[model samples]
Target: MQNGSSLSIAERGCFHTDKFDDDGKIKRTGTWKSATAHIITAVIGSGVLSLSWCFAQLGWIAGTVTLVLFSIITMFNTILLTDCYRSPDPVTGTRNYTYMDAVKSNLGTFQYKLCGIAQYGVLTGITIGYTTTTAISMAAIKKSNCFHKHGHNADCHAHNNSFMLIFAIIQIILSQLPNFHKLSLLSAVAAIMSFTYSFIGIGLSTAKIIGEGIGNTSLTGIPIGKDFTGMEKMWKTFSALGDIAFAYSFCFILIEIQDTLKSSPPENKQMKIATATGIMASTVFYMLCGVLGYAAFGNDAPGNFLTGFGFYDPFWLIDIANICIVVHLLGAYQVLSQPFFGFVETWSKEKWPQNKLVTREFSMWGFDVNMLRFVSRTTYVIVTTIIAMIFPFFNEFVGLLGAGTFWPLSVYFPIEMYISQAKIRKYSFTWIWMQILSVACLMVSLVAAVGSTHGLITSLQKFKPFQSVS
Candidate 1:
């Protein structure tokens, strides 16, 4: 008999309960709930850490409105992109496995190549950011403990590169999971961790407000003063654009997540439901965490909800929250970075379909190992770790990458694909409106990129390469 993968669908139906999909791949078991789990794992990331700061920069009015507006746009764009999962026929046509595949299927080779560069460039930035943040979280845990042991004013300095190395080693192990289909449990756990830390942050913020009273707040945000010069305020407001965008910019992996779903109930329909549900859940949490943190600290809100501000009471809880961040990022790093994984592995497999070194799987500790997967994943983790060690700025990278890729992958491509697939008349009301929306989003991304870049530059002056960041 042929190997399991080569078995005919009818044979597998008789031998196993799992049903193969149209692509003749292994049976998929992803439900809307699991897809939601994946979405949460990807969406609630380091960006969430910076929300309170973004809220502070934009203040009450713009902060609240911007969060809602981004959630709306993300939901709308993802809904459209969801329908583009399957080719000519979204529900029944041949499957497009990755974002690049979807682009090639809908748009053309020219666009596909361009999309790859933008997609992977932002993806690399994101992975590096995650590595840095994970180190910070780990370092915070140690520092929290040290402070508790020797009073709040004790020298609790901790280096982050060692923590970064430890995190990278963990990722190298978890990265062996093979694919998104195998990551359900990890994603679910990560989602729980995300909520755990988020709730803790909210609780701390609430406690501070109750015990200390409300902080200074305004409709227009922080007034120009010793805290922020006029130019600083403008740039910060612009950078906040990226922070908010980063919080909602998970559309790049929407197709990959949707691909994991069972074909029945239609992948598009289920993904749409999952996207809407996940976005709503995250939005509610973001609104609470951001708004409350802002209300508690107002103009002086910390850059990170958990560690940016002064040490919160019940120091143990603060340690737990930071620990949760580390755990959550362990899963999130894989989830967000899977798109690049799929792109590279898929291309390698197709390029050398029969090369045993690249394609052959060997059983080890009940897990399959292949050279392509091993080399590619290990290399990625190592490279990101080195970069994270060199320039460990979380907010700067998140903002810059988020703003850089916001318009193209999340907004522009989806709109362009919708127009192409629907055969809409040129310059019709719908087409004109879509074009206008894309242009508006593009302008927003440009300004955010500038602000984030400025912040990065400013940060660089104080940082030396390979210096241990605390």
Candidate 2:
């Protein structure tokens, strides 16, 4: 396999040479541990919080099945992506540092641009989801505290938009963290937060089931045809699949995360192990949270487990969970947004090579700051914050993003790239099975996208901007 030596002196100079060690390998600032932490952080976002509600739509059996299938599919796709990262270049060996780079190399320039669009779009939507979730959790905490201190007549309503704006302002600082490697510590914290909330949610659900009895639980283990028409039920099942797909939709950045690992052949092996560990850990967490939340609330489960149960009992615990969620999202918003920032910066540099606006730095309080980074990232955060405020329905928006982008990026693109790189024959067993899986995923995601889009539009019809929405 080709290494960095494949690059021309000029091209190598353009690269971050400092990142390479004396041994000529890219310095591995991240380890399997950090990679695992980052993957968990990336995979178990606010989407996991909605799995119980997802199960409510698909029932326990289907939801569990979908989650497991997605876990397996995601692991396979991630491995394919890691393989694509080091394709043998005829001239320079092979090296791909980003998803777009891999796409361009394996697919084509046009496909690369298309992938860029989907990648950034899904990432922006994820940032929006994070912001929206932060606001909702904050609002819930505020209301709970107010109701506890004041009577039922207390005006406990807090505008979610206000909290979103505040969170966006906070991101203005967090977004300045520079790069993925720099964000690893934050990612570790975010991973812990994910575990924290998952355990708490599971604990609460278990307690509820124990205290309240199974009779009070929404214990429909399987789907009932009589509850809805076949079509409606199918639509809901597909929608739930989209949610599961989205919950596992971190493949777009897998290469980027892998790039942060120590540069060596073992890096690929390390990534495989990390991917397996992260996916398994997250899948178990999702199952526990989803199953327990469903058993506790049954058909009445809210889209977000944290907000589904009223914030009355164990108010302090709920408060801690919400705080963790808000903080975790603060890190998550950055994890997803950094790629978008890099894309814009790279485009700017290429489009106007001599334009100082793209790289100009100024001093602020004795610290140098990039004007472009501040403006672009802050603007992106503000735009997403506004969208979050407009449509505060977390699950629906998350489902919409998952359905709209997961198929293309997570399933179709990776599998196609794999087949292209591997030269898999059209009728080969592996090729046929993967193609079938891709098509099935695509069809299900399309149905989910349409359903979620309709749901969002219906929500918009009733939306009142800046108003407190339950």
Name the best candidate (by TM-score).
Answer: 1
Q: Give lDDT for model 1.
A: 0.87
List per-prediction Cα lDDT, in the order shown.
0.87, 0.79
lDDT of 2 by residue, 1-470 (tens): 01325344335555465566423555667888898988888999888888987888877667778888888888888887777766653113466778888889889999999998899889988888888888888888887787788965788777787788889889999888767878888999999998998888999999988988642233343345586666665555656666777788898888788878775545677788899999999999999998888888877777788976774567788888888888888887888888888878767766766666666667888766777778888898888888877667777788888897778998888898888888889899999999999998888888888777766776789878767465
Candidate 2 — which residues are off by over 4 angstroms? 1-26, 89-93, 151-155, 215-235
lDDT of 1 by residue, 237-307 (tens): 99999999988888888999998999899999999999999999999999999988998998888887887
TM for every model, in the order presented, reads: 0.96, 0.91
The C-alpha stretches of model 1 lying farther than 4 A from their native spots are: 1-18
TM-score of 2: 0.91
Clashes of each: 0, 2
